[model samples]
Every structure is written in structure tokens, then in C-alpha cells.
Target: MNIPKNHLWLWLPFVVVVCAGYFIIPSNTFVQELVAFGIMSLSISILSVFFKDWRIYSLVKVLGYVFLAFFAFVKLSFYNQYGVPISSSALYVIFETNSGEASDYLSNYFNGTTYLLLILLLWPIFFLLKGLFRKNKFQEKPLKRAFLYKLFLLLAALGCVFAIHKKFKTENIPYATLTTWDDYLTAKKQLKDALAIPTSKAFTKIESKDIPQTYVVVIGESTSRWHMQLYGYGRETNPKLTEIKEELVVMDSVITPHVHTITALEKILTLSNQENKAPSPNGSIIQLANMAGFTTYWLSNQKPVGLYESIPTIIGSAATHKRFMATDDYNYDIYDGALLPVLAEILKDKSASKKVIFVHLIGTHLRYEKRYPKMFEKFQTPSKDLKFQHEKAIIQTNRYDNAMLYNDYVIRALIEQLRRQDGYSYLAYFSDHGDEVYDTMDFLGHNEYHGTRPMFEVPLLFWFSEKYINEKGSIPKDIGNRKYSLIDFPHTFASLSTITFKGFDASKNVLDSTFVQRKRIIKDSLDYDKR
Candidate 1:
């Protein structure tokens, strides 16, 4: 029943390779990489046992270790540079990069830390090389014992496979990469088709006054009303917004239709709603604004492409002009405030009588501490009401709140910029979806499978200039208390901008006098309020 020491040593190199990635990869992807690499190494070790020749067996084992070590080293280097593992978004960036751009990226990212991490990760290769050169003979085992050992290895491999079967679609790197590529292709096709359909064809009977007005749609990411002081959170996470509380229409009961960015934004930015689950034939709000004779501008701090083909990116492409501050997902240096100068230039444009600007902020996303500057690290102390009082949870919650505080500054700055413009202007700010930073649960991110209240409870705020208020009439006193869903946001946005098209529903618009509250459905199944 005992295995030879020489045979046992075969697993050492693989283990070392796995440990390299284990140290750098995030906790979420840890188990997937562990199981995947574990199964591979075990299978290879078993296969190596069949090689009667020592040289061939050593070669196979060493080759397997080297192959895995190479990938591990690459992954570790990427993680060291980006603070994230090699993702589909990173891959897409690579695929799209020209020779010049690739050189630039290499020069920028391949710092001393990258080389240091790579050197550490590739150290396992030396172990494999030493074993390859060692004078060892392949010892043949007894027939029964050999069969039993093979059976045990096979059973172990099968068990690992069975355990990870359900998660294979999402957790496995190969599956995720393939699916993500397919999704990107599909989304690219959809985007191409969408762009082909003329604005006149997408929306019927577009009517606009062609007035000298400016509308700014500021979209926030992973921000929750549950953590914001403006929404009654105990922490002062929204000091700037609170200061201008009288001037803003802070809707209290707004929830996103979905917990994920792509799902929520696809519905929020288009006519697709609970009643109409299909892709909106009427195009996005950007297209609608374009048809209304408004010069559209999409200014964003977020990367153009996320893990998959970003629906927001596809929607944002419909704008008359677009400017993305952050080049890649890992570029955390670009804050939301970077969009201010671009917006200022757009606001100064006298070329268009009316302008519709969309500002997308990377607000309160994961790695919350990186979402803001050092000065915004105000919420260091954990709150008493935190569900989980552990160190990690407390730190995450504090970082999220600090990110929210910085988000307050960015939103206020956008509002002020819009106010300075000499026109009827209004700025609407809302998160694509909310994050769960251990508020009501012991979770730090949003997931559709384990849906929570904080995951869908987004912040929807509106700031209007005096000219906008005088022209469009004052916001209703009861508007803040209205139970609304972002699924019907396009209608509300259209109503606010006075842009109407065929089949436009006044009942769905929260700003309209006849606005009616409908059941807030999330994930196309659960009623959010009822849940």
C-alpha cells in the first residue's frame, strides 16, 4: 500500500506551481485554479507511472510541470501588475492591441514587481529540471498493487470532476474563456446590427423642441443606497450630496431589475422592461437622444470592455462623441473626476443647441480602497450595525463607505459643472447595480444566485438647474417616496428631457404626472419588494 518516495516527489513541482498562483490570485478564483491544476497534476502523475522508461516518465512529468509553471508565472505576473488574474477583459485587450500599443503596455506594466513575481513563480521549473537530470530508474510495482494505485488515482480524479461539475461553466478558466469569447462575438454582432438600424428606424415619431438644453446621465457602478448617508445610512458616506439635499431629487425606493451590470444596464438604458423582456427594438436612450437632435456625448471612467462584451459599452457607442478615461479594467488610477474636463469641453460646445451627456463612474466597485484617493479614506471605523464584525468584513465595509464618500464628491462636481452651463440642465445619477458590503449579509459582492436586498437597492438621484426647474416645472414633493424601478428608467428619462416617441408610456415615467408604480421584478422572477 506504500508508494515509493521517488514517485511521491513527482507531485512536488506541481504543488509548487499551484502555490505560486494561490498566493497571487484572488480568493474568488482560488478554488477553481486549485481544483483544475490539482486534477491535471494527478492525471499526469498517473500517466507518468505507465511509462516503463525512466527518461520518458521524467520528461513527461517535467514537461507537465513546465507547461503549468509557465501559465502560473504569466498569471502571477498579470496579478502583480493589475491586482487581478488574467481575465477575458485582459485577453480582449491583448487581442485588440496593435504592435505599438502592445509595446506601450509591456513597457508600462513590466515593472520591477512583475519580474520579481515571475522569478518567484518560475522557481518551480528548477525543481522539475533537477528531477529530469537525476539518475533514477522507473521501478515496476506488483500487478495487483499497481492496478489498485491506478484505480485510486482514477477515482480521485473522477471525484474532483464530479464535485466541480456544476461550477465548471462559471469557475473553470477554459470554459469561462470560451464562453466569454462567444459572448463577446455575440455582443459584437448585436452591436453591429444595432448600429446598422438607422435612428429613424429604431424609434418612431421622435419629437423634440430642439431647445438649448443639456442633460447629463451619470451612471454609477456597484453603489448601494444602503451604505449612503443620503439614503439614511448611519455613516456620513455622502456628505457632499447631503449638503445639496434641497437641490436634489433623491429617490428613496429605487431598485435595479438585475444585480449584474450587463443585465441591469441593458434594461435601464433601453426600452426593455419586465413587461418586455426582449431586446428593445427602439434602441437605447442614447439613440433616442440622438434622434431628438441632441448632441450626445458618452464620458466614462470605466473601461470600454469588461469581462464580457459590456452592454453599457455597446449602448455608449451610440453617442455622438465618446471618451473613456480608463484604458483597461485594471487601470484604477483614473477616477470619476477625470471626466470633468471632457464634460466641460462638451458643455462649451456651441455647435449643438441641445446636448445629452452620459457620464459613467466606476463607483464603489470591488477593491473599494482603490476606487478612491488616499484622502477619501474617511471611514476607517466599522459601524456597530455591521452583520459581520470580522476584520476583513470591517475593512471592506469601511473601504466601500470611503468609496461612497468620494463618489459623493464626483457626483456633486458633475452637478455643479452642469449648473454652471447657461441652459436648462438636469443631471440624473444612478448605479447600474448595488454592492453587498456586509450590510445585511456577510457578503461583499453582488450575485444573482444569492440575491440580497442591498445587491439591488441602488441610489437614484436627480439634480436640476434653476433654468431646468423653471422650464420643466418643479419636481413633485412625493417623487422621492415613489416606489420605482430602473427598468422603466428610459421612459422617465425621456419624459424629463421632453423627448417623446411612438408607444411612449407616461405611466412608466416616474417624472410624469400619471406615473404609476409597477411590481419590481428582479432576475425576471422574484418580486424585489415582496422578497
Candidate 2:
């Protein structure tokens, strides 16, 4: 099994190229690069042995280098522009872009750094070509241990297959691209089917009082009640909301049925609940409001694309008018306050006698520091009661608290803007789900597999305008303490708006007199309260 030194050294160029490319890409990890190197080396070695002709093997090897080098360049350029890897959303946008738009993007993004990265990525070609040109004797005759060598190669191929399967299960670039493409196609088909379903079939009857009224639904993201002063946290993360807590119905026991954004929002905004896990045949709240003769508006600060078309975006499209502030994924520069002006403009519209507005905020999502402005960085240090004492955990806690503080300002501003309006309006604010930022565990993000209390306990607050309270009576004495899950959000929303249709369950409405306490299930399996 002795091999020539020249033959062994030939594969070194491929390994070096792959490792360099991975190191340059921000999204790739050290372990991923190492595994990728192993797979590449083993594959080339096996192929070289199988292909008896040296010229054909060299051609195959060069083709592999070309493929890897092309993707590496594209990924590096994308990272330079977006500070993130190329995602499905990015690919979707690219494919949808016209020639003019593509030109503009190239002109804007392709700069000195991009060219430098291309140059750095191209250096491996020289080494590869030099090694290919150097004359090395190929083993044309059968060796003594040919059977053993073939068996070893077979085992190596199986190991590579196992590694590839494991890597595909992760969030690596190759897996992301393939899965995103599949999801994009599926979502496109679902969106088409949903659009074809008539609004009339979704409801038997839609009845509401013919009066000038407005309802605002604010959907927040990754905000936990445990971190807010309004919920009795020691930090002043909710100073603005705390000042007017008396006027707001702060629902004390509300939780989301899921932790992820798309799953939780699909249930929250539609009639789909734990009992009915399938897509709701009855349309979303926006469609319901539209059927009820209210001019609906959907304004969002969150990106519309989550890998593919997010469920929230699909549902939001049912509104009479929809505007998403962020065009691309991971563009966190846009703040929630930007949505306020749009809300104000929508509130001022006089053409519609009745109005239902949905505002989605990117409140306190991961990379917490990017969620808020520098001025809102109020919490510089972590609290004394933090369970994890590491510097990174402490920083994350502070950043999250600061983001919460900014969110407080945004929510209070929304209430005040609605208060100045002339109609009977009530605004409901709730997060799609909460985050685990050094709370109950050392985790900083939400994971359904590793469920925790803070990841499901979201803040649900309601602000009733003075005129609305006078018209609809005072807030219920026991409404805030009612055990609630956001799966019944549309039912409660209908109750608040005095709207009724077929299949509307009064017991599911937290504010209704027939409201009943049901088991709050999370992740489709565990009881949230019992857990």
C-alpha cells in the first residue's frame, strides 16, 4: 500500500483551497470546513483510483475546483454587501430582479473589497494547475493488495456519505440553498391556492355594527414578559408602558403555542389552533376584517421573507394595503418607530368608515444590539440575579433589556397616536413568541426542542381609547388573569371588534363572558403550564 510522494501531495492543493475559502466566509464554522475538507479529499482520492486514465481524472479534479471556487466567490461577495451569507430570500430576490435592478445592485456592491476577495479566492487555481502539470507516474498495473485497497475506498465512500447526511441536517450553506428552494416552491403553490379560495366561502356570515370604529393589532417579536418592568422585572425596561399601565389591560397569563415566528404567527393570525393543526379553511383575521367591511392595513417592520415567503407575510397580504419596511432578510437597520408614521397616515384616512390595522414589529429578535438604537441602550450591565455569569451572557442580557426598553417606547407611542384619533379604537399588542436571553437557562435564542418558560411567556397588553371604553363599557375585572394562548387570538380579536361569523367559538375568546380556561399546549405536545 506504498504510494508515491508526488501522488499524496497532489490532493493538498484541493484541501488548502477549500479550507481557505471556508475561512474567508463568515458564515462557515471551523468544524464545517474540516468536514468539507475531508469529504473533498476522500472523494478526489476515490475518483482518481477509479478513473484509470490520468487525463480524465485531472479534468474531473479541475472541474470540481471550478465549481467550489465559483460558489465561494459568490458567497464572499454576498457577505461583503449584507454581512450575512447568501440566503434563500437573497436568491429569490436575485431571480426576481430585472436587468436594471441587477445592474444597480452590482454597481453598488462590487467594490475594492469584493475584487480583493475574488483575487484571494483565485490563488488556489495556480497551485492546482502547477500540481496537475507536474509529470507523476500513474499506477497502471494491479497491486498486491488490490482487494484491500478497493474495500478501504468503499468504506471511505460510506463515511463521506454519512458525513454529508449529518451536515445537510445542519444550517450550512449547501443545505440552506436546497431546502430554501424546495420551501420557496411549496410556499408559492400554497399562496396560489390560498389566493384562489374565495373570501365568501371562508365565512358563512360577517356582521358588525355599522359605526366609525378602528382596531389596531400590533404583533411584536421575541419579547419576553419576564424582562419587562410592566411585568415586575427589576430593570426599567418598560418605563413608558409602566407610566400608563392603569389604562392598559396587561394580560398576565398569555402564552404562544409555539416558539418559532412562522408557526406561531400562522396559528395566531388565523383560525388554526391546537385542535385544528391543519391550515385554517376559514381565512385569516385580515380577510375576516375585510369581509366585515373594514378597510384593513398591514404595516410591518420585519422582513417579509423567512427562508422563503413567511406565513406572516402571506397572511398580511390579505389586507387592503400592505407595506413591509425591510425588503431583504437580515436587514436590521430599520427600527420599529419607522412603522409609526405609516400607522399615523393610515389612521388619518377618512374614506373608510371602519378600519382594522395590523402592525408587525421586529421587537427584540436575536442580535439584540441591532434591534435598538444607541440612544435606547439604557441597560449597560446585567442584573445581579442572572444565572449565567459569563461576559457574553451578561452582554446579551443587557442588549436584550435595552431592546425591550426601546420596544416600550415604540408601543407607548403607538397608543398615544391612536388616542389622538377620533374613533372608538382599541389597540392590542402581543409578541409572536418570547426569547430566552439568560432567563431560566443559559440559552439566548428560542428552540422548540429545548423549550423554556421565558420562550413561551409573551407580553399581551391592550390599550382602549377613552371613547372606546365609554362606548364598550369598562375593562373586564378578570380579563387580564384569564389563562390564554395566542392560538385563540383571532377569536378574541373578533370579540373586541364586536364582529361575529359562523364557526366563531365564544369560549375561545378571552374577553367574552363565555370564555373558558383551556390547556395551554406548546410545541404541539407539552402543556405549557404543567411544564
lDDT per prediction?
0.75, 0.74
> What does candidate 2's lDDT look like per residue over 1-531, in tens digits?
655443444365445445554645454454554456457566656655554555565566565665555655665566555445565655544443334335435643467877876776577666556645554455344235477778888888877767766763332345556777787677656654563232535676789989999999999988989998988888889989899988988888999998777778878987767777655354688888888888888898877654235566777877888788876443345578888888888888899989998999989876677778899987887688788988978888998899999999999999999999956999999999898888787666775645678888999989998888898888876678899999898888998998999888889888778999999988766788887
Query: What is the alpha-carbon lDDT for the whole of candidate 2?
Result: 0.74
lDDT of 1 by residue, 183-241 (tens): 76776676556742326366889898867888999899889999999988988888888
TM-score of each candidate? 0.72, 0.73
Q: Candidate 1 — worst ten consecutive residues by lDDT sum?
A: 136-145
The global Cα lDDT (0 to 1) of model 1 is: 0.75
Q: What is the lDDT of residue 374 in candidate 1?
A: 90
- Model 2 residue-pair collision total: 0
